[model samples]
Target: MYEVIATPFLEDFLVMRPGKSGGFKIPFHRYQELRDTAGDRPCPEWLAAATRKAWGVELSGRSADAVLVREPSSYGYARASYELNLGCNYDCPFCYLGKKEFEGLDWEGRETLLGVMRDAGVVWLQLTGGEPLIDPLFRETYGRAYELGMMLQISSNGSRLHDERNLNLLTQYRPYRITVSVYGATEETYDRTTRRRGTWRQFRRGLAAAREAGLPLRLNVVVVDDNAHELDQMKALADELEAEHFVYSNISPTIHGGPEALSSQSDEHLRARKPFTGCNAGITHFHADPFGLASICKVGRDEQIDLVAEGVEGLAQLPPIADKLMLRTGGCSGCALQDKCGTCRPLAKRYQEANAPLVSYCQHGRR
Candidate 1:
């Protein structure tokens, strides 16, 4: 009966509860008071009252008291990313999924899979892909996941999502959030980046539809060489639309471990990559592709474990490489590239090119 709680002011805090998406984020003093007052008992009276008062949820009948602790790991994964389908209408030159072939579980199969993940202690599930909404079973699959008490997030290109039918379907399930990747701010740039005519207009239409429906909408401005010049316009567009949130992403790599994507990466962006921002893949995050193959992260997508054959238990058997920051072999081993190394080790290893040098992203070359 133990529950996890979070405070609005603090970072993500977790209590040792299973399958619960952490508790409400209340005020600071109130959070401290609840922590101080809570005791090991059937349930704390003050904590329950505080929660009810703060979040307007009655927890009196609940069996166990809630507590704040470090976020859970290992057996309990808080979030899982699923590639719903590999079918995408627009073909971007820099696609990392590598000319994805259409694949997805049928409705019954997806339903069973969602149940398995929920039972395995996953509370937040992100539906992503070449384009999640393109799949025929996406709506039903999303609805089933939400009904299973899993907080749902979706990553989309906004093509089909702009359709009135698809918008209505998404509105029905009411996802926690949806991220629409904006390839470019203008039609020319957008078309160039996505290599598809009419996508920019469709993207705008989708954004408008999402906003009108009051669905939580965020923007992912995929900054690539093709659309690098319009980064400011993209941000301005997001601001004008009053999106819930927006972020820039230029770190995506080519599928074959090439530095072509890096060629267009800005100098500022390269310098920004100098920090050791760690990865949270196998540690607390996991990704499963459309074929029911699970990987530690997007970079490790090729190194997949068959989720259908092994189920969630396969996650336990996955290699614990999430913490690895430095390559033990290859040209990068003990090299002075340090923080400025833009070579993704997983991506390098994916194409049998581990420790290979990438001059386009190396600070050593500039030095």
Candidate 2:
């Protein structure tokens, strides 16, 4: 699909600042550097076309900085988890999706999901699951998703894409983002971690199919202790495929290093957990499960602290879940990281022993 596939510049972007000991680290220099570099680069013609088709925007008013910060949430004008079930078949110990049997909504429920996305003004509809390719409704749901005037983004385990029918159904939409999960670059480590045989091979083939289908792909490398050293190699592969690469933040906690404790073979330094260290979950982007909605990180979906429909748009609904959002160990009230940190409640509970600060994050003094 990409015969000429000319390389693109990676210098125009910068990583999000990691929280430092003194205070939240904001890389103003990198931020400014990106802003200056952005104006010089001609935005991709395809991206401009995608944005215009999805949201009917001129794409001329946009800036690169806005693209980076909100890119995770949307592809351009389209923003949402539309057509998404967010389920996963593999039990990656570190998966923030947590463990659950595959579940999905009937047609009516699916419409409700779309309704919320419309309310949120989403232009791109993402269809994810415990491997969306495995869903029985895959073709029908996918067709309907694009019919809603939302560009399709599909996240898959890559195992089933080998089926020509499945591949054909997906390629028909002309997906804007196709994310495939690959834990380890090498087959041994990848298969061992997943406890499933031939996963890496299937993943590679799926990626090939995506490229053949002319889909823009992004590869997700969950950084665990095993694959941490090859992070550069993974990035290299991404470059070779001309696909974007992302190192997913760990979902499991770091306080405990046992197999169960260490969710995967990635290298992730735990971020400090401070009570008053505020999170942008409810305010910025919230996570929702079937029951209701989680106010904090996606892992906190089980806790179901806040309902997305309860009238909280941004920072206003945090107080309702304040207690559940607290640090169990030192019980921080005003730790500075409170505002900038993910403060993933599950990480704290999973990593720390009963009533402890999350192992991956900083501990505030007991209130």
Candidate 3:
């Protein structure tokens, strides 16, 4: 088993340890030198010393296999997010996924999908879902991705973090980070927001257990009308756990273009987003839904490439698709404030389709 991964990140080379965040960036020559060394040979002196200093792991006598060197790829994506399943235990009205249908590929299909991601040069992979931890094949999927030399991150609601089996598995094979969503600080408010009676207790227990286990955690403070009054309390709770956190106030329409979720947005807490800067969504990163449909990003699901059927070769179609999606052609066409608009095209289209008021996403609405 490899302890470190030497892979090509976008335009640079990196030497990173498995299950850890942050790594050392090396020049092409240095990467080449390490790659040329035989895998069965003893670990290189520089690498051994670096690992000892950085992670306190002594790689002195270990063979070069201690470091897995990934081959460079013509495919551009270096990061991707995969939805393992869409089933959840709780029902939050503000969920953008709309329908929480529990359906996805079988284990064999999942393995093949992961293989395609690896071949496409995905180095940083995020495992997410309605509740990824509850997926029946969570352990198998996570283990396979780790074995394929991809650093893993997870997004969850934190309801199952207290389970002994989950805690044990996560501790043994660490994730770079687990991002948990915080609906409210108090039990009543929390339960009301999720529309689940006992979720507040489970979430609290899970958070405490994860903190005690010394896991890297980040809290996404989901601000909505139901929990808006508890914003400060929520932040305090995150601080009490000593976890990193950020506030999320903007609410979007459901994936099917329904405006129902927009009603939950907290008016007072909502703030304008930064200018619509270009992103590498489809260019250097992509999102895979439960069925292995690859799209430019989560919001732009209009055009999807079936990775399960076409494999990595299908990724070639994404760049142009990304370009086309970014253009302001519909309600946004011929607008003078295009450069100042904060929302991206695909997202804007969703709001327009839902007949959302201008103030929700338009610069003119703010004026």
Candidate 4:
């Protein structure tokens, strides 16, 4: 097991620790020096000093192979999100995933998928799902990703954060951050929104345990009609836990192009998003579902590459797919407000397919 990871991050170089947030950026020359050092040699003095200063750990006498892992890649993607499985313990009416099927790759397949991600140059990885913490292979998958030197962020509903096994694992190999969703501040509202009794107690316990364990956390206030009245209280709850928070008011159609989730949108709370200025989804990052199918991003799933079959080489097809998906075709093509449109092409297509009201996605509808 290595204590630090030295890798290339797009155009820059970074030295990061598995469980720590933020890392030291080093010049090309310094990275070269570390790369040139033989793995069997003692840790470089400068690296030892820097590691101690950055993470309060001394690596003076350890071999380079034991104290550090150098990750070099030819691919371009630097960040990615993997859905361990599409299963959940709670059934939130507003879930974009729609059908929450509890099925995914087995342990062997998952290990192979993680390796493929590593080879594809994914340094910042997010492990998510309907609820990733509850995946049967969550521990194995998480531990493997950590050992592979990816800085991880977990997206969850916080229902399982209180589990003794989960807490122990997370504490030992900490994630950079855990983003938990807040549906409501009170038990009644929370349980009602998730359509599960006792979910409120479980969520509360999970948050408390994660906090006590000193894990980095961020809260996403999921505002919906069912819990819109508790918006302020939800924000206050985040403040009470002293976690960073974000408000998510806009709800979208389900991934399968169903308008069901749109019914839960809190109209008053829905805010206009900034104009789409473009993103580096396929060029710099991508998303992987449970079956190891890679797409440009979460929203644009029209064309996918099967990583399980094609391996890292399959990622080469993404940039072109992304270009095609981003064009404002269909109802958006040649629209006068194309430049000022807030929704991206792929997402807009979903709303159109679902027959979602124009107000939900189009500037024309707002008029």
Candidate 5:
């Protein structure tokens, strides 16, 4: 019966019941009109009924109900990326996580955190890696969120998802969506990207098991220089599986601000990427590290606010802070190399070792 309200950046308002796993989206302009109507309005019966019908949950009136008010801005936080734990099995060359040190809130703490986020107006929660399936806290946290009706999204490498236990877990919780990163279409390409042989076979096996279990699955291909040739094959494979797919080519620096992984970005990768534009980090989206530290998003990892210490109430204090932190620097404000620049301030800062280099983030042809 908890009410979850989300105002996504560049999008509309999403009002949901996480305990029921159902919600609705409303345009910001219309939401504004609704917000002006005033005092603690009870959710419309139609919305509640539609939600319950969609997610197959009853509104028991156990959790706190939520209603959005006119905040300072139209965009409100709606989505959150929860890094259950940073430990991953695969060693992808282009991975941004680097070597993750395992740390996160305990099961009880995780449960509390979910409730806090729900209260704070987050409706869409993306459970991500290293590999969310491998996280020790995954099952408990996921099961609890399912019980509470959180619209969950999972990002995984498809390594452990084939296990019968994991497949059954997916069937039980029924996440709204599951995104698996397809490293390559062939074993050789997979090995080249992951540096792990025979993982392609394991990935296929897991993907089949998940599909057999009827899990809602989506595919994402990491378009790296090494796998650039296999893009067609990857898309064909996704088509063969009848799964929705997308390609990721923007290779940002590692969390440690190192350039070693940047070598994976090729000229083709640079050409394929869309131009740097505005980000919805602090305004509409956020990321929580394994240690319960929250930030605007993954790119802004360095600028973090401890969620465990401040609680949901602390979430209110971040938008203004994030606005201040989004400034461009290192001669990027009006650079003469605009024609060659391939990244924005946050990325430029990371690639330049926090110095904000004057050149593009891509080192492939530039060097």
Candidate 6:
């Protein structure tokens, strides 16, 4: 909670290099419009410092208790998410991980990843995928991830969670937390948003099963044009479910296609690459394709910075050449939110490099 005054203000953020529609240059004039109608009394105290740091030294307005911490790194009572799987079942138009050349993944990638985790002393493994539950490799991957003595973070569409057998299996795997997509408060909305039928029921069943199983849970909602108006309803559903935590954010442009590519996209998109502003890839974490072709970010899926070879071991393994394979590079140097944006490198190809800086993304979103 913070303060709000009558003042006009504006600021630029970053998504992926390209905009949302797989194209990059996205001018979110909405911020300017919002500021003009906003007051300048004082932002909440919590948000003041974060705003200053992300936007650079000088910020005229006050603040609030917004995001300004390193919490997005490692979650839970304790542990960090070692990346796994990239394919997802949903294809909301606003999805960030563009339709990449995902095909016949060598399951060996998981074995290699497990080895890396063992060497790095990683304790928590985050499981994601085109649909991790559906993947035939999950049985092996789950066992391996568990064998590494790491807590697993399972993020899913929630459709599979409802199966009693699967739910029991999940219990055996002992995932630390299950983050599910909260696309809508009703089935009609969810089915349309996910571009599939009968998904809403399955997803809800999964979430309920997880909750009943007492798996610590969090809910993620992608706030977009089609659903922003229903923010309250979404929250209400979370409350009804008694979720431990619920988060809402815009679809990131950091993956394959940027937000602009989804111009015809609906608002109920889900998040692919976790949202962040100043994406210091390899500095702390690395992204990976199923085959274990590590990328800097998810958008400009490049191959230059493959950490899998030497593995995310000591600092020396990650050379000084921190190229923008996934995180963007162009417009970043001059952007006000440079340190706080999820500037994906892939976005460079999605949109004209000229307008990257003027873009906006959720800065280190989790915190």
TM-score of every model? 0.75, 0.61, 0.98, 0.97, 0.78, 0.63
lDDT of each: 0.65, 0.51, 0.91, 0.91, 0.70, 0.51
Among all windows of 10 consecutive residues in model 6, the one with the lowest summed lDDT is: 15-24
What is the C-alpha lDDT profile of model 4 across 165-230, one tens digit per residue? 999999998899999999999999999999999999999999999999999999999999999999
Clashes of each: 0, 28, 0, 0, 3, 59
List candidate 1 stretches off by more than 4 Å: 1-74, 244-251, 256-271, 319-327, 337-344, 347-359
Residues 1-367 of candidate 2: C-alpha lDDT, one tens digit per residue: 1101011112222221111001112244534443454543654455446445544544443344223321112211123343245455565666545454556566655555555544443444456666778776677777665554455677777777777888787665466677877677788877776667888788778778777877677888666766666667777878889887876645454223223535452335333333444454433344444433433444443244323344224323443454455554434445465555444544554444333334444444222
| Candidate 6 residue-wise lDDT, 1-367, digit = tens | 2111111111222111000111111144533333433344444333344334443333345322221111111211122343345456666665555562335345675687666654444444567766677666776777776654455677777888877766777776566677777777778877777777888888878877887887767788656665566677888877888875456553445353344434533335434344354445544444456665554444435443344565544323332434534334544445565454453544544544322223333243333
Which 10-residue window of candidate 3 scores lowest in summed lDDT? Answer: 57-66
What lDDT does model 3 reach? Answer: 0.91
C-alpha lDDT (0 to 100) for residue 306 of candidate 6: 41
lDDT per residue for candidate 5 within 1-367, as digits (tens), equals 2444333433455555333344567676646654554345555554456556665544433223443332433335667989998888788877888786677788767877776666555657899978888888788888776554457888999988887777877776577788999988889989878988878998999888888877778999888888899999999988988889988876767877877677787556664334566676787778888877888887777668777777877677678757765666654566655554556556666777833232335433355
